[model samples]
Target: MQGSYKDKEGEEFWEEIHEVSTNFTLFLIFLHIVGVTMSSRLHNENLVKSMVTGKKNLNN
Candidate 1:
């Protein structure tokens, strides 16, 4: 005489989905960092420093 089994199943499914989404988000963050680092190295620019200081040299 309480919540039905179906409700419990649905809750478990949603929990698993939430876990998967969280893991995917973390993976995306890691991928972005790698991409930024590789790009900085390839371009020979201190991208992270510029981003933190909000200053970039203009060669115009």
Candidate 2:
């Protein structure tokens, strides 16, 4: 907050960098959901429940 970018180039630079950052964050979230779903189906487990309880069954 102590400094400001006075040039158009700086604005464009930050915009592009943060755009990639946003996309990467979204991709990570998508992967997390897919991984949880896959684990639930493949292992016969309720992953959401386990997350809530902070425990997983041995059979799972």
Candidate 3:
């Protein structure tokens, strides 16, 4: 690949940035799952199923 940065320091800096961003994104995803699980338990609803089916089960 054609080098975009002028020196090794620049490349290393960007690589670090990429790694940090990727990890942060995964962490955020984990938090999202936790939030969903908590919400499902608190509300006593199958939130994941509803999300997948695009329908909510309502008891009459």
Candidate 4:
């Protein structure tokens, strides 16, 4: 009976895993914002160019 259920370090292990998961989620959110901003800017630029020249840039 010297080493029963109370002799484990489960709490500390779970805490570390939770912290790492939170940090990874935050990083993914940041990357998503950056990508969306860039894509919107590019789309707007192409639209403006097409309006001025009366021709669509199919390469975009």
Give the top-scoring candidate (lDDT): 3
CA lDDT for candidate 4: 0.75
Write the number of the candidate with greater TM-score, choosing between 3 and 4: 3
| TM accuracy, model 3 | 0.85
Sum up the clashes in candidate 3: 0
lDDT per residue (tens digit) for residues 1-60 in model 1: 468999999999999999999999999999999999999889878889999999975653
The per-candidate count of clashes, in order, stands at 0, 0, 0, 0
Tally clashing residue pairs in candidate 4: 0
Candidate 2: where are CA atoms >4 Å away? Answer: 1-6
TM-score of each: 0.86, 0.77, 0.85, 0.58
Per-residue CA lDDT of model 2 for 1-60, tens digit only, reads: 434566666888999999999999999999999999998999899989999999988861
lDDT of all predictions? 0.91, 0.90, 0.93, 0.75
Best of the two (2, 3) by TM-score: 3
Task: Please state the error at residue 51 of candidate 1 in Å.
Answer: 0.7
Task: Give the alpha carbon lDDT tens digit for every residue of 1-60 in model 4.
Answer: 655565456666888899999999999999986876687587754554566699876664
Error of 3 at 12 (Å): 0.3
Off by over 4 Å in 1: 58-60
Which residue runs does candidate 4 get wrong by more than 4 Å? 1-8, 45-60
Question: Where does candidate 3 stray beyond 4 Å?
Answer: 1-6
Cα lDDT of model 3 by residue, 1-60, tens digit: 467556777889999999999999999999999999999999899999999999998973
